[model samples]
Target chain A: MAADISIGKAPHPLAVLPFYGTGAGFFAALAVLLFMTAGELTGHHFNPHVLAIVHTAALGWGTMVIFGAAYQLLPVICERDLYSVALAVVSYVLLTIGTILLVWSFWVFEVGALMITGGSLVVVAALLYTVNTCATAALHQNSSVQRAFIVSSALWLLITVIIGLLLAINLRVTFIPRNHLDMLKLHAHAGLVGWFLQLITGVSTKLVPMFLLGKSKREWLLYAALVLQNVGLVLFLADGYFNPITAKMLIYAGIVALGTAAWLVYLADAYRNRLRRKVELLMKHTAVSFACLAVGFVLLPMAYYFTDTRWVSLYGTFLFLGWITAIILGKTFKTLPFIVWSSHYRHLTGKVKVPLPKQLYSERLTVYQFYLYLAAFVLLVAGMIADYMPLIRVALVLWMMLAAVYAANVAKIIFHKPMITDGNRTQ
Target chain B: MEIELNSPFAAELVKAQTALMQVIDPELYVNIVDLGLVYGVDFTNEAKVKVTMTLSTPGCPMGDAITGGVKNALETVFPGREIEVNIVWEPRWNYHMITDEGKAQMGLE
Candidate 1:
């Protein structure tokens, strides 16, 4: 009968920072022609403009946003307060400055000393975040959901940074591998799929159902999916550097099995609880993202059948640009608006009349973006498969345009416009 | 409309229940109806309503948010209505307060 003291009374302002970062990251890519086209014109693969766009998107836009959400959600699910908000703020500052230094180093590749310093700062920031999550879990290990996500995410982050530092050292003083791109597949996958995608899905398993009025009953299936993924990733990284055919096959099989099983369970849950019969744009796009995941997973086994790396690249295209980014965009719509609404309007009740949360969005625009994304993803994947350069370029442009629209929608939510008349009547 | 003096109050109760369902705790992510919070709702007049509810646990952080949400939701349905939310800590909320539907949703037999 004792009350649970852990429930947060208000939506923290710090939590919404990540949403803003996501929106910013989505739009910033267009500014530098995403670092490649600009590079071609300027005859410099390493330019301040390109570095700014890349680092801004990667660290400023992606990692920071993820950090903000985790700081708020991890504590709640764990039924404990975070290790230190002050420490979190410190980590954020270090990461921000570190990213700036990194972009500068990219432009001046001769700055071996500077690269080492920036890389160390990034590692420290990751360490701080890792320590924060692990320390919080040490208290009241009640929520298994929180524990799994925090631990797994932290481990992957450590792996990501360690690999990153080694790469930097190689660039500076040839400390490890001779080939700069040798361990790249491992480094990229560890950070992308292992650290980012794994954490996102793990958290989604809990949040998606809680927000959307669904239930996740297949805990065992989730665990199975998780283990298979990690095993595959580790094995892939170990032997993939040498380009072993058997190792590649095992990795592809493992990824396919993991993605398919998770998708099935998620779709089944969503279908069962959609009795309200009101399918939001976010849900529609989320299903689209899962379809991309399924297709990408299915294509993995094809890599063994084919001898070309083209199939592998196509599979990567579907997984990264198609599945991972799509999910992030789709989920951000639901989560950002809610966070903004709660923080801004929760206290306005009883003082006077207030507009409903549903009034804050244009459902029409969101639905359009969802359909456009589906078309763009399909075109892009097909182009990649067919080796049609023109089609691939057009699809990327379309993807960028849709992403721009999504970014603008998120920006409006963050800025907090009066969506209805007489909005100020409620204090 | 058929005029029935004896049970004219039945329609008002249904209207009140519908309004209550719209109220929700933003943080807990559950509405008052499913939280087993609403104990009773009494209507003194067409423009006056009283709600009696308990929290999941004593000193729940969501106590104020849920109460505010209930008031807001009701006011929206029946504007300028006099609403009073009474927070009680008696027979403290447990599995018993959960209706069969709520139990099913929670997967509790």
Candidate 2:
């Protein structure tokens, strides 16, 4: 089959820009908060302040970018416009307010009305996003593997949020019979593997090949990944409820490992066949991300087997900051430049000499940012394992610098002024 | 597959196509003609040239940029001549419409 080069329209950049900007702001703030509270967070992941920090990073920074990118990407892949731009705006507003309120409530350890209201708003926001994505996907003429990945991932997002809300309510009501810690583990896994990883896998399968100018051949690998991931998630959730610290938990861990390995293999094949001989700096970060995913998967089972809080923290760090955050950073650098260039310089094509999409940003700055990010990530994992406050604080500083560099690069692209090479007027 | 070098219209067509190579679909990193976006070119008796084209998707946000690029390219080649660009959705563009050169460039060969 020939490659689908159809140029589908994207939602206006304005529709998605707020999410990226706000998410970056929250990420920068989280880095600072991490530095200030490094002493308090040492070996205590479940404290209210720590919870606030985690949620701010996960929901405000990570999921926020996913929401925005989805709106911009889904339409192009599906060959349809967004079903409801108005709904997307509403979702963004609700998500922003909800994330702020939830973080504040956790910071003050107020598990009362404030927490309930914030949690509810987030749930509603997730529901709205799900509706919008599903409606858009429904318009596609044929069923595709990409569609399966995206639609199922959206469903997982809904489930993850709903379970989260239940856990929040249970904290006050004492409705669940199981241990709160075990339930919390379930909630975290559901969000990380089911919602985040699943969605990332889906989007990357299509995008990686296009970026490399390579053909995507293996459909079965994607299907297998989808099946294994969902099955593993369901099993893990069951294990969390039934046997939180038993050998049976290994079943889910093994399944997740297989799924992750399958995805890695598929991606590796695509890269091997790529026509683009030179691997860009962004792709170098992506390769590191894959390695991080493998490390995290390996550590997950060991963490459970050892039953050590330090090991658990290390696993979370590798998965979240190393794998997910690295991929997001890499993709952001690649995607944002094209978006900015198309919005600004596309009109000048043929009429006047214009810069290529890749020329819109500074690659050197991006490379430096990636190095800082990797260093900080390593220090974070080491600090968590050793419970070293100073190391954690230093890592936080490095992370803040990385975020700042990223923001600066994005800013330059957005505000770029084209230098006209030809002095011809538009007829 | 070769243009008649003696015909003024054919010469203009070649010039227009060559200029159009500069108008790339940024996402695909390929020219619009190779991506099969351009469908027909006509030199009308009223001393005007008309180009018909379609985007990969109906909702393409780059519609204005592409149409503008087409006009700019034709105008540069055939100056002082009226240029008309008609964006039609009919006979939708597909990957199969890619020229042999385009196929080779895209590594499909």
The residue pairs in collision within model 2 are A9-B60
lDDT of 2 at A195: 87
Give the Å error, residue B60, model 2: 7.0
**Model 2: fraction of the reference interface contacts it also forms:** 0.37
CA lDDT of A306 in candidate 1? Answer: 76
> Per-candidate DockQ versus the true complex?
0.15, 0.32
- Candidate 2 residues A1-427, lDDT tens each? 2223333555667767777777778878778777877776545578887788888878898888889888877876666777888888888898999999989999998987888888888899899989988998898777877778788888888888888888889888889888888888888888988888888888888778767755557768888888898899898887678875566877887887788777778888888887667777898888888888889878877777775667766776787678878887888766766666766666678777677777778889998988999899889878877887788888888999998988887777767776543555332
Name the candidate that leads on DockQ: 2
Instruction: List the lowest-lDDT window of 10 residues for candidate 1 chain A.
Output: A37-46
lDDT of 1 by residue, A216-299 (tens): 566766676677667767777767766644534555556636754773586477557633345567877667777777777677
User: Quick one: best lDDT, which candidate?
Assistant: 2
TM-score of the second chain, cand. 1:
0.79
TM-score of each: 0.74, 0.87
